[model samples]
Target chain A: MQAQTQRYSVLMVDDDPEDGVLVQKAIASSGPKVDFQFVASGAEVLDYLFTEGRFTDRSSAPRPNLILLDLNMPGVDGFSVLKQIKSDMDLRRIPVVVLTTSEAETDIVKSYDFGANTFITKPSSFSDMIEVMTSLKSYWFDAARLPTA
Target chain B: MLAIYEYLFGAASFVPHGYCLAWRPDLIAIHALSDGVIALSYFSIPIALILLLNKREDLAFKRTFGLFALFIFSCGVTHLTAMIMLWEPYYGAQGMVKAVTAMISVVTAISLWPLLPKVLALPGPGQLRKMNTQLAAEIAEKNAAQVNLHQAYQQVEAQVVERTRELQALNQRLQDDVRRRSLLEEELREKAAQLIATNAELERFAYIASHDLQEPLRKIQAFGDLLKSEYETVLPDEAVEYVRIMQNAAYRMNKQTKDILTLSRLSWDSIQFDSLDLAEVVEEVAFDLKERIEEAGGKLEVGPLPGIPGDRTQIRLLMQNLLVNAFKYREPDSIPEVHVEATLHDTGAPGTGGACVEISVRDNGIGFAQEDAERIFSIFQRLHGRSEFDGTGIGLAICKKIVENHNGAIEAVSSLGKGAVFNIRLPTSQPERREIHAGTDTAV
Candidate 1:
């Protein structure tokens, strides 16, 4: 209910730095007054999510309303992280979205199977990503009422 | 009495000695028989013609006409020879009669000459009549064709009128349609745009999902590790077992998810086509898997491989997977022996036939039930226990997909406890084949 008035915090984890920056640009361009956090790998997400190790300070590490993940990573990949996040009672309440460079059907099915709330392939061009983020703002921010757990 | 007796004796004694039908002495009888023979000889031409002309396809007129000509000529020969033989007859043997018969035959032979010209002439009576009939038929056909054309023209005129009206209506509709089409095209373009966007969106979603999911997966793996490492001491045996099982499942899922991503990427990724020597590829794979093969105490045998248009990196991966399977599924207490052979097989039409290279990899592995042969090519379909043989269960399926990308097929032949041989076929042709066809055609 609080998300109805207040802007939601988005936590995006991607191995590619350019992409992470691109997503940030897209969110900003959409004119949404939102908090954005970027983590390089899936391992960092755990520290951030559970408030453990480097993410011990809760104020600096805000509770994210949404999480975007990339399936491919060097160590402790995306699907494994998704399963664990969805399995936990506390973490399961937050909406998780999957982002990839491929429109592969298997990833879509698998991501959802692991309890991903939404799936989106990262657009190639800057403009397309901006457009998608604009529509996403229309849908997630305006159209649909997200669950409060 | 004496005169009557002399007349009777003279009449009785007038018959020539040894005069019989076999040696005919009577000129009238002989002449009559000669006339009959001449008549029959003359009729043979028509008889041969009748025989030949009975069936439509039996024989043509030219052959029968030729036979008729021969019959006339043969009859002339028969008559002339008969006249020469009959020159000195007993009862009515006369030179004049022979001369007359010879003359008739010579005249008849002359008649045969004109008949031949008539026979061999380009157009006979029948042919001329046939020509007339054909001309009439052709004229009728042409008239029919003209009528059809006229009807068609009338129909076309009607159609044009209707179509013109349709065009006017269509012109109005077309304007609407053009706008609609533009709108539809735009809608399609938008739909395509959205689909593509959604596709990209989906990919991003997967990436994000994978990225986000990894965090929790790592935590599961890590916490499972943490629990095992830190909390295993005080926990109950059942709890420890549950933690271990959880970790096992989590790790298994992690590996499997990663493998599934990899396998699916094989389709999504672009395949590079280059001339790859399969022998060289196999050798490289064999070298890479040398340690594994040696550990399994297995031997790798290779064959004369055909060079093909293929992706070298992918092919190397293909060979690696096959060899790995060979090494992984070896018989109990036996060294692994894997043989990789490639040979060209002929297929299709004539000298310009295409070539298919059959690459077979045989291994003395723990063979499967034959029914499971096809099942092995399915994703996540495993024949053996994870303890007995460890795999992502997508190795063969990936191999099949890779082989199929090259327009090839893969088949497995094996029996339980014996061994397994995997056969892969790729339809490949030589680059120089175009040159050969071009050269031969040029020579001709």
Candidate 2:
């Protein structure tokens, strides 16, 4: 398994289009630009990661460097999605970062328990979102090594 | 003592009722001896009287006196009668005087016959009991009077104590009333003072929500406009995604406005009241959340619900919010489980009305930190992450308001990751509406 402390393509699995867009802006402001993709639901993420059906071009779709998950989405929320990602041995080493709009303790603890690499709160302001994104870039890209592409 | 035996012995004289003894010196010596013996009779009555006087007090003094009087009178009469018999002379008058004196002494001794046996009957212990029996009724009457007086005094004392307690309680009530009135006056002043501050706060909140939050939201919306209208065809996928990000923040801002507005409205002093069946209200909520429950692969086990007096709309809102929260915070490994139970109780519990009912909702989900147990019922008190769970944080707060409106109580108990239980107690029977005779209902 590749070490989690490496740069790879990131995925955002969320239902809210608005939240997905906000997270994208936050990531853009962050340094050491990395490739990223978005999926609408846990099912789509799983299918894309597994190269199933619509996601058959496995070579083109890179293994996720990290996953930013939302727990309260349509079908098979973030927790179930985390369970599947962590359970699959081939994909288990990939880092997971939980990006949420709440600071509830239960979510933080559960995110860690399910093997998330980091838990970040969704900023209420656009500027704070930028800060969260810049920090993510510094920690994951500048301070840590990236897996060979 | 010698007096009676003298007669029985036939008192001898010097002359022997003739001149034989008087004429002979030897015979006269023998008569002198007999005369000397008869003279000892006078000492007997005094000795008998002394014996009678020994136990004198216990004997009714009057009876003793009367018996003594009888003794003396009979003694005198017998003495005089013997004196007359003795005076009937024989041959010589001087000699007859001597003989008569002898007969008088003998009769005086015999006078003790009737009185002797009676005098010997001194007071014994049995006589005391006999005396007590005779006087017992009188003694009892006097004692009964004293006891009755004592009992009446005790009753009076007890009444005084009871009155003292009542006066103390009344004084305490008055003191409490004064304290409460002062508190109310203070609260009225405080509320009056807060009216201006509250208005100012409300205005500030509206400004923050409208302007500060709207800046980024508007920028996001404009950037989206700029991208879609100007560069939609030429821009790369990544560049278009950037514009979409800005637009998403704006849209969320618009939604937050509505949520905040509803929260502000919740602060309004709107009294909720309506007489409705609580059971039917819960059923409606269960029906509304049926889809969520099924999707979670959990069943909402509703136990028998008791019909109670409450606001139907507010109660329905409370059940809906909590059940939603349960489903949202489901444990990863375990399916969500919720048990809703309601029952009425009368035992006049502390938080309960003399006749009140309780509704309990227990859930098996990801429980929160113990510290959050109380705060979870506050506005915007979310225990789980927004990315992990979705909530406005005001759901439990609304439930609290609904319960309080019914003059009821609500509380939550939870352990970390173990589960949580919410208990709600509401007055079932209005104090004034209670029947003169209440019907007991124990529905478990």
Candidate 3:
């Protein structure tokens, strides 16, 4: 079969601006071309996903093909956001990958229990970060098939 | 004897031969009255003696007193006869009565002669009074002694009552002390449980802090790497060197945070123990370190290892850390050789005490000083500089923590240039589930 050349979009939620910039740069450095959007906190992730408030223009803010969720934030943390996404009929089909600095077993287990697709610890070096992004892109975009968006 | 009795009877004639003296009424009355009074007095004395003797069965010398009473009675009869003759002639009867009285007197005198010495030896009334006074004095002394004894008895009884009361008071105090101690112990137990929960919470916080702290450090290192690689051609050499230094520091900080997280994660509550074959753990560790072992030209000889109760992942990590240490710290000219051996060791004697699995990992490495053997297990304690060996200095500390979580003991023995041997003793049976309670007062 011919390789499906479908473009994908990712919504990343993180409170730290530096971490968000680093992840974007690392993904851009690595090959797979993906459209990325950044939201500061978990509450903004829900608004962006449902096209509410500032994200009311659904055409301009496209639905994310995948969600990169951070666990710790000021309000409405990643766990609750994940719960809201997985429980909603419109957003349950979207794959949610938890990317956080916490390597705690409880965090990993809780993310999975809340219907996260994958849990990955953010790598500490540029090389390691690139390697992780490469693997994530290959597995989600190429190997696994997604529902119609 | 019959003829004498007849003569005595015929002698009772009324008159004698002539003695027509003056018969004066006054003289007659006086004489008869005096004789009658004397006779009555003597008769009363004998009757009283008879009554006394009859009444007092324990009275001494009964026959002698009877003889005295009879003699007195005979004398009274003689007086009576004399009085009767003064009134009537009766001279023959009077003469006969006199004769009888004389005979009785003679017999009484003879009997009295024998009893006279005995009567004379008896105590007089005056002497008896003196003896009675002495006896009364002795009785008074005895009564006084008896009173003193009764007083002493009362004092002793009082002392006993006092002692009993004191003992009861002491017993009550002891009971109160025991109750107070138990209450304090219960409160202490509750405090200990609370302390353990707080300690667990603190550890969790440490883990979270270390984990979260690594994120920014990671970003710094990544950006520094990107800056270096992307601008290597355009940037000056000094800027590249600065980036290199920044990246190195970031890398070290990252490693330290990771080690801290590992240390905090080594908690007993999170460990699950099972019967594990340590040889399998060693094999896996060796496989994982195959490249390093081959590069170092190391020989790992693993002997028959016994099964012990322990957390599988922690035990694997412990073996890996030790093996890596053995491979890393080798003599300059010597080939690395590590011998891992396990044996069943009885704490006391066979079948007497608990059985333990004694595991020894001996390495042919450049050994540390003897004093540093204990210090090596402390976190971030390094004997050599970072140039000599590259490590976070947390491997042995993690190993120690893992062994402690298994309720086991671990120690290292080493001398300069003689290599090091690590001995681990683990119970074959499951260790008791230990709850992390607060420390005791003494421990605190």
The model with the greatest TM-score is 3
- lDDT of each residue in B1-444, candidate 3, tens digit only: 766555544434544222232556666677778899998998899999999999999877788778778878888887887777675555555667778778777777788788878888888898899989998999999999999999999999999999999999999999999999999999999998777878667666666557656766787788998887789899999999999989888888888877776776675246667878888889999999999888877899999987777888889999999999988897666899999998887782223357778889999899889999899999999999887888999999999998887767889999988889999877777644444332211100
- Cα deviation of B391 in candidate 1 (Å)? 2.3
Question: For this target, which candidate reaches the highest DockQ against the unseen true structure?
Answer: 3
lDDT of 3 at B270: 62
The 0-to-1 C-alpha lDDT of every candidate, in the order given, reads 0.72, 0.67, 0.82
Per-residue lDDT of candidate 1, residues A32-147 (tens digit): 67789999888999889998888999987898888888887778788888998999989998878888754556778888998998888765345566787787766766777777
Candidate 2 lDDT tens digits, B1-444: 465444433335522332433446565445544443333343355455656666564554444444444455444444443333332322243344446555655555565575577666866788988998868977898899999999999999999999999999999999999999999999998986686567556645654564446545645664475456557899898888877776775776655664564445344434345566766787888888888778778878888887776555567777887778767777666799888887778754335546767788889887877788889888777777767876677778878876776668888888888778888888875443321112111100
What candidate 1 gets wrong by more than 4 Å, as runs, is: A1-149, B1-202, B205-210, B226-243, B348-353, B429-444
RMSD of each: 28.4, 24.0, 7.3
Residues B115-192, model 1: lDDT tens digits = 676568657789999999999999999999999999999999999999999889989987998898899999999887
Q: Is candidate 1 or candidate 3 better by lDDT?
A: 3
* Runs off by more than 4 Å, candidate 2: A1-149, B1-235, B239-257, B347-353, B429-444
The C-alpha stretches of model 3 lying farther than 4 A from their native spots are A1-5, A25-32, A141-145, B1-38, B46-205, B228-245, B264-284, B307-316, B331-334, B343-358, B400-410, B425-431, B437-444
Q: Candidate 3, TM-score vs. the true structure?
A: 0.72
Model 2 / residue B172 / CA error / Å: 24
- What pairs collide in candidate 2? A7-A146, A21-B245, A71-B387, B86-B100
In model 1, the Cα lDDT at residue B443 comes to 5
